[model samples]
Target chain A: MTREHLLPENDATGKQSVLDRYDLWGQYVYGFLLRALSSPSLAAELTVSVFDAFREAKETGLTDLLARARETAVAALQTANELRLQEATNFDFRMAQRQSSDDGLLLNEKLGKAQSALEPKCKTILEMAYFNGLSQKEIEGALNLPDGSTGTRLRRAVNDLRRVFALN
Target chain B: MDLKAYMTSGMLELYVLGLASEKETREVERLAEEHPELKKEISTIRKALDEYAKLHGVQPPEELREKLEKSLDGPPTQAAVSSRPMVKPAHRPRNKKFQLGWKHLFALAAVLMTIVAIGMAVLAFDYSDRLAVATSTNVELKEDLSKVSAELVEVKKANTNLQEKLGFLASINTRQVRLNATRRAKGATVLIYWNTDQERAFAQWDQLPELPEGMQYRLWAIARRNFEPLSDMQSVSSPAGDIHQIAFVPGASSFVITMEKADGPDYPNLSRMYLQGSLN
Candidate 1:
């Protein structure tokens, strides 16, 4: 049998969090940059960028850190160690994609391509919400939305994005 | 608690897909805070969608990565912002893929456990089989050893007889006599025994008739004054019965045979005499 050891959640704060630990954040950002760039030099550079962004937001009290901390997917993506999370993400994404047209795939490659082609604003919001660890509440505060409008806008934006991604 | 309303509101699925606006996100978060099932549904949807995204994550080219890296390092590298995603895989999409489920996981575990159990059973069976074979072989070996021991005893008896005969060959006077069963006519014969220095009387009865039931042959020693028993004898079976004349009491010197009860009498049953011999 495959003896897989499931690890405990790594949220140091013990709250709903995605990469709440800095070590994991560094690993994931570095991994993303490495896979996307496939060069150590570029990965190192992007590592600086992600942390730099984090620091800049923190210094200014720009609500971005809270945005990330309270991000909608914090709970699902949390892991016990930076290395395992990075490895799992890298292994699953890098190795296991279908290539043929008639393999009966679930995700729409065309729509995926289109979603990635979206306006920089939409891309930023979704990626920050998904990968950059920004929360809708923080986004609402950042955008200066009325007290109750942030969740509605986020939901509407996401549904639109999903439809775009779903379209063949 | 308000699952029905929550469902019709389409808040749960949208929140799960990360579709809710900032304020809507707060609302859903608040509902999740109050109701565990809502949180549960949220977690499940997020997990499924997250897995889906992970399966289809973008792999930007090394060149694009380099450009992005360079831009992040210093200045933005200028390229036309194309509408197409550079990282999009060059392939068509597929659909209706089934997910791996808990039942499959449990089934796999059960099969693995069964395989282990069967392996143990086979090993135990082999061990028992070996034990049975060894025990039977051990018993047969013991039987063979006992038979060999009995044969060794007989060999010792024969060896002593040969040694006595060899002594006769060394003596200055060597005498041998032939005798017969008186009533047998032609069926029974015997040999007068020999020993060095008059050690003792000895004989070998050769051929004797199969006796009728209720009768046996005996030996007697005849003297001028007394008909005394010399040796113990009975209906003979083997052609070569040992006549090793080991020391007898000083008083008895003659030998004879008679028909008596199965057990011969201590005194000569002269009335039932079948064979007679006397020593000078």
Candidate 2:
């Protein structure tokens, strides 16, 4: 879908209609949480909580909604001790094989290309840390990398991703 | 701090991903507050992550909307209500026999009034103290704001300079001419970015030898067969590291830099030539 279709239009009054925004962005927030938490049920629960909080806070922007959803998901993961290394590994596989048509979501072409251009290990490290919320030491142990290498790898991966993005 | 190194260190990505340690987070926040470039970089990282998240967005189950609406429409739970500060009951059940007499009521009113008076006095004093503290904080904040504003001005100036240089380098019409050092100055090279479209040129050098006192470097643009003297002579003690803008003579076949006495005629001294480069 085009961005115009994905984004909610303001009402006649020119102010963003809250329910419209929720409808438009709810799936994206859910997916973000699901990616982070790796559980459909937990992701669903937090997605609802995120929207409720967003409504109560009178936040209309997608950025704020996503930020709140991320925070809520991360807090839930921390509280439930749900950081699963296996799930992160699976996520890496899914990311590699993921296609825009699979989800019927408007994937950002630039970011998708940039992400796909990353080395497998670098991409996995990013997924483990960003999506799985694994600490540097946890990532090193999980990947069997030498001590202090996780940070270096993570930095290089992110830098590479940024460089690729800049190039494209 | 080497901002380029810090920016590429990936700490910003980690920070944006909410994975940075508390100390690292603080450092990033402090630096971002002080440096506009860092702040811009942080913003870019956040945007990239946000886009990445959006790229992987999945359509939630349809039933999820119903669940969200039900929760929104439902009344607050007991736990939710209990989390708020307790409010006194608007009315208490009356007992005729336990009612107070007029004299008791008057005495109670007097005591309540005394308590209220003391409470008001205490509140007034607290308010005054808080007001004073707030005023002091406001003054400090103003000072900090002014300092940040000054720093912002300087950063903007630097940013403009960098942007101009980048623009010149990126322009298709701009030609990069490397001026090779002559026999007098070995192992020295200068880069000149000449923008033909804008008729502007900038020169940069790394290791040009220091000239003697009262001697300066002059630039000449050779257009056709005639030499045009470009304004802005560079002294050795001047900022050699900075990219210096020079007059761009149109259709210049070549350029030359020569060292001459500070008081010498405004012309290139062929014998004192230090570097030369041709457009061809």
Candidate 3:
């Protein structure tokens, strides 16, 4: 579904109604947290928390929703002891098989391909920085890279993905 | 700086991924305001990552939906539909007026008396309803007035504090001392404004890492060959907005900040010193 379709419209009382709109993007949010957290239960709990905060703030746009989801997930990752398990596992760039037969499959398929095409090192840096919420220095230490290489690798990976998407 | 080169510097990617330091984040934001292309690039990176996350979409457990619904306060109830008031039918007089006997006249008079009593009762109910509404409105106005008065007091207090800060900072007697981060905490810095005339000092910092549980930061003035405590132990999470007033020593040669146990330390723990600066 498009971003516009996911926005909660105001009801007769002039308050934004979110439940139905949430249904449209709940899986998208859950998937994000699930991959970042690797625990269905923690992801679900944070998913609920994100939506709870979103509704209270009466946020209108899709970008705000996604940003909030990322922020909430990052905060939870910091406090959660389960991150040690995530750290032990090797980084994988390939997207897991899509479970939901949703309408955004075409767009997701293209995105999945672009993500999988990234170099292994690039993928590892991106996942560590974005999903694991590690700082550039932390990623550098973890990967045994030089002090300033994490940003360079991340930029290359993102540019590669952007180029691939542009070709499509 | 060349816009194209700056765009390719990977700072925007780090920013979008939230891997950039606070200083870098601020710089990126400031540049984005000057260059629309930079803003657009940031937006594009953010969208790409968001979509990548979306590609991994896994439907949450079915039971979770029910649980979230139960947890949330349900959508607000629809506004109560108001029904239009019924209009009274107009009274019509009969074309032929028959001569009335005494009994008929007596019956007519009793009916008219009952209608008048009913009208008076309706009027009394309507009057009482309006009076109740007015009373409620008066109470609300009083509450609003009290809230505004409290807010006014707070504003005035803040204004006074701001004026005092400005006055101190503007004084020629005030000397700014820069505290460089020590090896214990690299990249962290603090500034101290000491007004020699008044022997009062204030400290400010950009950001500081969170300390371990039950640990707090204490300031020390290295003066007269003694480490004198400059302020009470401060929590790392304390707000950075207000300029913290620190005890100023007249002949202090330097200043030091160290992390110490929340309760036990009366003097600086030299090994835990995080920042230091000399008056010279």
- TM-score, every prediction: 0.28, 0.46, 0.49
Please give the distance, in angstroms, between residue B215's alpha carbon in candidate 1 and its true position after superposition: 3.1
Top candidate on lDDT is 3
Give one digit per residue, the lDDT tens place, for model 1 in B76-120: 333567545678568655776778999999999999999999999
Q: Rank the candidates by lDDT, best first.
A: 3, 2, 1
Query: Considering every candidate listed, which one attains the maximal TM-score?
Result: 3
Q: Model 1: which docking level applies?
A: incorrect
Candidate 2 segments exceeding 4 Å error: A1-16, A58-60, A81-114, A146-148, A163-168, B75-280
Q: On TM-score, who's better, 1 or 3?
A: 3
List pairs with backbone clashes in candidate 2: none
- Distance from true position, residue A158, model 2, in Å? 2.8
How good is the docking of model 3, by CAPRI class? incorrect
Q: What is the per-residue lDDT of model 3 for residues B1-280, given as tens digits with 9 covering 90 to 100?
A: 8988878878889888877889999999999999998998998887777667766666777887776676575542333344455679997787967787999989999999999999999999999899899989999999999999999999999899989988998999998997766433556668889888988888876455466555667877777767788875455433646777788887887777766666845765443456677676
**DockQ, all candidates in order:** 0.01, 0.14, 0.19
Q: Which stretches of candidate 3 lie over 4 Å from their true place?
A: A1-3, A6-16, A83-112, B74-280
Ranking by DockQ: 3, 2, 1
